[model samples]
Target: MASVRVEALTKRFGDRQVVNKVSFQVADGAFAVMLGPSGSGKTTLLRCIAGLELPDSGSVYIGDVLMDELSPRERDLSMVFQNYSLFPHMSVKANLAFPLVVRHRPRGEVEERVRRTAELLRIEQHLDKRPNQLSGGEQQRVSLGRAIIREPRAFLMDEPLSGLDAPLKLQMRAELKRVQRETKLTTIYVTHDQVEGMGLASVLGVMNEGELIQYDAPAEVYARPRNAFVAGFVGNPPASLLEAEVREENGNLELRGDGFTYRVGEDLARALKGNTDRVIIGVKPEGVKLVRAQRAPNDIDGVLDYTEDFGSTVIAHLRIGQGSISASIPPQEGIGLEAGARVGVRWDAEKLSFFDARSSERIV
Candidate 1:
């Protein structure tokens, strides 16, 4: 396994730039995932690193070798594409051995490597089966095996789990994590799925409009997003944003929204003291508490819209005044909240996030 690095990478087509000055490093044996929406240049950036598409500028480094001047073959990186891309006529064993065979390794060596890879990926029983004979999950394992047998410097996977069903995807995700941990291979994964990225990647690079918006640990990115875009994009159910006014009352700061007023924490209040009256108040679903009735300060009256049950937890959608908000409630809490039920929502002052209205950037 080896580290991978990209510096000042830029890719352009015609007058449109697909990637703009993208730069990040994948530490040795680390799983780094690049995530973004469609047309956001995530795949293009991966292709650039794999040498499938050369960049117009910037350099890529795999270990100590500079890859910008080298061909894909010379870069010695294995890539598993979105589609299985397995040779239909070849058996799983043959497909796994193809990499070593093409490199002119001895037959005994190829057989040993292929056997080991298939076993590691738990596809030993399907070695003789052709691609068409295997299930989608099995074929994905075979593709991963082919990449693994190469024993390249690093593995590049582009949305490898996109085609599998939910259960199969979950199974394969766990398997992939185990394989990566056991082999300790440097891996770069490209995906638009935030769940997949957050579950597997040790480090995540969030891209938007051809540039990386944030590069950090998954928890860090979710908890302390640098700006509104990162905050809005990284969380599940996403963070809630409300248009509110910040004001000082009796020498204490408070955030006034349509139907409620919340006292800001001392630290947060200090950060927004000199800011304009209008600011965006952001909070995660978990931060908002849905109570059966009204509470003290920081509470807002609303009518429950609907409940989304996801097994262990329920997300309550509430209409507070002219705006709507969602809160995650524990299953056993059993507020029995339903559509059109009157309710109140409250959150801790420290849980609030303050962002500038004009720039949409976090205050602190």
Candidate 2:
């Protein structure tokens, strides 16, 4: 296993910059996941590291070797693509053995490596089956085995589970995590799925509009985002961000919105001391409590716009003034919340996040 590092990497296409001065490092034997939306240049950044797309500037390093000029093969990395790029005509055994064979390893050694890899991926019984004959999950396992057989310096997986159904994807996710932990391979995985990224990564890098916005532990990124973009993008329902203005009401600091006003504590006030008057308040769905009765402090009355039940939990959507917000609640608590019903929305002040409206940078 080897650590992967990129320094000020920049990639551009014509007039548009696809990757802008992105820099981060994946420690040896650590799993780093790049999370972003579509068109966020995450895949392009991964391609740059794998030597599939050369960076216009800056440098990439695998262990101690600078790889700016090396070809993909010379990078000593195995890539598992989204489409499971396996040979249709080759059987599973041949596909797994192909990497070692091409390197001119002894036939016995290649067979032994292929056998071990197939067993590790739990596809040993399907060695003779061709790619076309295997199920989607099985085919993905074969692709992983092919990559594992070579035992490359690091693994680059670009949304490898995107082709599978929901249940199959979850199954493969667990399998992939198990394999990576067992081998301790330094793996960089790129995906638009926040759940997948958070579940699999020891370190998470969030990208947006061709820039690396935040890089940290998955929980840290979720709990304390560096900016408003990271705050909105990392959550499941995404944080509900409301535009507000900080005002000195009496002796206490208060955040006033169109239909809500929340008093800020001394700690929060200190964090927002130098910020502009205009601020953004971010509250995750779970942070918004749905109360049937009116409450003091941070409560805002709104009408229940809709509710979505996800078996065990329910999301109660509400319309406060002209803005829409949602609160995640237990199914039982949400049982009486009906559309157009009057409800009280309370913010969890302890979990509230404040951002500078102009710069979108987190202030508290």
Candidate 3:
């Protein structure tokens, strides 16, 4: 279960390049993830894929082998960090039999694979406790049962549940996606959160500052974001960006903004014909929906500016006429919109997205 890749992967520090030419791939057993925000080299690209940091040039395969000539335990791979480093006088069944007793195996097959990985990570009633008697999600399942008792062929992990606490990081993200799909293994997973990389990978790269901007899948990188740093970094009250202009009217391609004009749809107006005036528009906070009046294509009104319930969903914050956005409503129509209230937003010129206000790219 391997398949990682990563060409062009530069990684400097002396002259401050910190990761620049990054590339991506992660197929084999697939769980991928990466994500960003925080010095954003995403733990220096998961410490250069766990050989513990090496890339000054490129290359770091995994299934086909070339892991920069190996070491960090010959790069077979199994990392899991964010600190639950275990061993405080071991005993969660000796920390899952300390990696099958450092690979010597045979103590009755290391107590039958530590009683089947402590009953598949429920931590078998905290196996005889230690590491200060467990619980930070049982010392993160005894550091993921010492990396799933070394079944390693690949699994990297860096922000291993960033020290839990949002209901124990959502119950250790559904018990780490049910023990990575019952040991399918080939992981990767570094994180700067974004709901733990859209609730556990299966492909999503993203990264920033050091670059790798958008690898897709998690609703296609939150619906087709290819630039403007992935349409202002994947969504959730994030993609509003306005600053329109692109005219061409009679042939119909509008956009205009600062009060409102919009149209832009003959296939997004031929993908904004090289921006006749400026572009940017990107809408998505559930694609701007807070309606209760003025409706019939791209409506606009304004001044509601604030309301954030989130008990299921309610995000209003609009100021549309003077251009500012935000609208995720639906907690039964957010109990009839409030704060200053002059509402009427609408949005769906074929779900408008256009970009490139000076190379922020994606005009299609």
By lDDT, the best candidate is: 2
Query: For every candidate structure, what is the RMSD over all alpha carbons to the true structure, in angstroms?
Result: 1.7, 1.3, 13.0
After superposing all C-alphas onto the true structure, candidate 3 shows an RMSD in angstroms of: 13.0
Worst 10 residues of 3 by lDDT: 267-276
Backbone clash tally (model 3) = 0
Per-structure clash totals for the candidates: 0, 0, 0
lDDT of 1 by residue, 105-153 (tens): 9998998888789889999999889999989999999999989897889
Better-scoring candidate (lDDT), 1 or 3:
1
**Cα lDDT of model 2 overall?**
0.90
TM-score of each: 0.95, 0.97, 0.42
Q: Native-vs-model 1 lDDT?
A: 0.86
lDDT order of candidates, top first: 2, 1, 3
Question: Against the correct fold, how does model 3 do in TM-score?
Answer: 0.42
Better of 2 and 3 by TM-score: 2
Q: Put down candidate 3 lDDT per residue, 91-132, tens digits, no spaces.
A: 879877987788788899888888888888888888887878
For all candidates in order, the CA lDDT equals 0.86, 0.90, 0.80
258: Cα error in model 2, Å: 2.5
